[model samples]
Target: MTQNIGDALENSTSQASLAHSRKISEKIEQAIKEDATQFRVLTGDRPTGNLHIGHYFGSLQNRLRLQEAGVDTWVLVADYQVITDRDGVGPIKDRVYSLVTDYLALGIDPKRSTIFAHSQVPALNQLMLPFLSLVTDAELRRNPTVKSELEATDGRPMSGLMLTYPVHQAADILFCKANLVPVGKDQLPHLEQARVITDRFDARYGRPKGSDKRVFPRPQGLLSNAEMVLGLDGTKMSKSKGNTIELRMSADETAKLIKKAVTDSDRHISFDPVNRPEVANLLTLISLCTGQPQVEIADEIGDGGGGTLKKMLTEALNEHLAPFRARRAELEANPGYIVEVLHEGIARANAQADATLAEVRSAMNMVY
Candidate 1:
């Protein structure tokens, strides 16, 4: 009887998993059918450092697609969120500039997308107060992304700001009235919280169904199709790990880094990530940049071993990044160009954020 009960539980769990997957598929199909112009997408990165290839494939490239699809895209620098864990702001100014430059070089047209620093938008900050009341401390701590991030800090005590990171993100989404957010599977929980907060606020303060006073739109996650790009060490690509290839790195720098990448002694070239992570990582990088299948890459590098594979990867990477590097160099030479772009973004963002905040204040009866 005990074994029978366990089998039944396993079947039920499997069924639930199938249902969830079907639901996600339906959402993706619906999103594909929707008019892109109707989507106001809010997505961004923290200006902690230079973006890596992982960032390029994972989010930046998708942002370009969405922008070109006629979607109104807002890319936030999220500079304010940097203090949640770090003790002091280290080279934030330079990093912010680099982040914007990376975006532009990679095809985020400033005219088509609004790219602004988080700290520069005071109205977004103001929305946090009312938003805080809508979420609980327990809910904040339960977020998987927050939990994983804190765990990565090696037992560092959580800060108040860190605990409330999801709420702040909610403000970022709603302030712009964005109806879509681009995220990976791991970030779904963060987007879920944003949706929950929107529902609660709408229920509590929104007008009748027919009224025009509806404030926040429930933001939906537009899951990215890009596969996760692992670092040369076969771990998540991170700047702190010293394994990432930064977008700003020259061809020589990239080649030098790839040459030192870890790989196994297996005489055969294959794409088995389980046993041959290093080789698989190299293949994944090649496939992403070259638009080739991993199986094809494995076939091409047959029996040539890790040395030949690394050389091929280095060549492919240089070819892939050459245009981006040239464009970045041209933009970097005119440092004032970045400043002007940020200022324009700030102005546009402020106008939208201020309007949203005023509506929130009026809804909460805080406007005197």
Candidate 2:
């Protein structure tokens, strides 16, 4: 409530975006009078595992709204980053396909937007060279997300590919010349890096009297307002944590998971997340799924103990997931539809990436 709700909501529209939800909140608070319709948006996800409720509520749902709102949307699979961060790539193809299935199930029509894999379009990575030259090693080391990731991996830095992940992301956004990037609070630094790089590039080659040619636009953060949906264990809802509720989970599985969700022993059903993280998380999930306010939901469960709350949450979650499950089943049966959709996205995305790469090459005088 203390933050800018508008920017937060916009950032929630793109959690994986470079701008944090909090930054977006402030920007929106400041720019309340301007029309946002002219903006082109870019955001994406890593295909590390199955899509979950956190992703849906935090980002994908917002993407659907953006699409309907007439914003030009570009959603990338981020397959290349996934490979850079982790080791084994055995089931990479399956995960990418599953991600594609998620887009279709969530109503991300390929005809209305561009959706593509990071690896399929090779040109995007090439921009990394020029983009990287704009920043120093210390700058990369200072990035919070990058530092957190490196620390999380126990100081085991991956290959050069992983080290330069931010540049790749810059290429992703600059390729489309996006004006808006919907991201969560944690990713703001990356976007800032992109902004700095864009500015540097423009300054060096921008079209002034007796000046060079400009190639990119510095995009602003759209910041999402989505609250973090915690997993069963009160941590972020991630598949790696084994605490996520899969987007395509069956009604029975959802009920069972809700029932098993960690909650306090307190007999009261309240919205006190500080003391009652487990119960509060369940309430949060239910509220997100049911479109009911947390206080209203807490009032409904009033001191009935964990079982009653769990039961209520189970019912709400299952009911909420009914439509998505149905859609997922239909999409899963016709695997070719998913492939075709991605192929179409890949083609469209390639055109955009190719053009951006051409401009970069021309600006640097790389052409023969």
Which candidate number has the best TM-score?
1
TM-score of 2: 0.88
What TM-score against the true fold does each predicted structure earn?
A: 0.91, 0.88
lDDT of 2 at 95: 92
Misplaced by over 4 Å in model 1 are: 1-34, 149-156, 208-213
Which residue pairs does candidate 1 place in steric collision?
none
Q: What is candidate 2's CA lDDT for residue 308?
A: 90
Q: Which consecutive 10 residues in model 1 have the weakest lDDT in total?
A: 1-10
Question: Per-residue CA lDDT of candidate 2, range 1-368, in tens?
Answer: 12332243234336454334466557753553365456678988988888988888899988887787777888999888876776767588999999999888888988888889978988877788788877767666556666667788875765677667777888888988887788766666677667778877775655433335467876877667788778988887778788978887888888888777888888878998888777888888889878899878899888898899889888888887787789989999999988998999999888888988878776766777
Clash numbers, per candidate: 0, 14
lDDT of 1 by residue, 1-368 (tens): 11222232233235564456347746754765586677799999998888999898888888888888888999999998999888988999999999999999999999999999979999999889878877766567667656677788787788888888888998888999998888765566666677777767776776433457678887877767788778888888898998899989989999999999988898679999888888888998899889999879999999999889999999999999999999999999999999999999999999999988878877776777
The superposed Cα distance between candidate 1 and the true structure at residue 336, in angstroms, equals 1.3
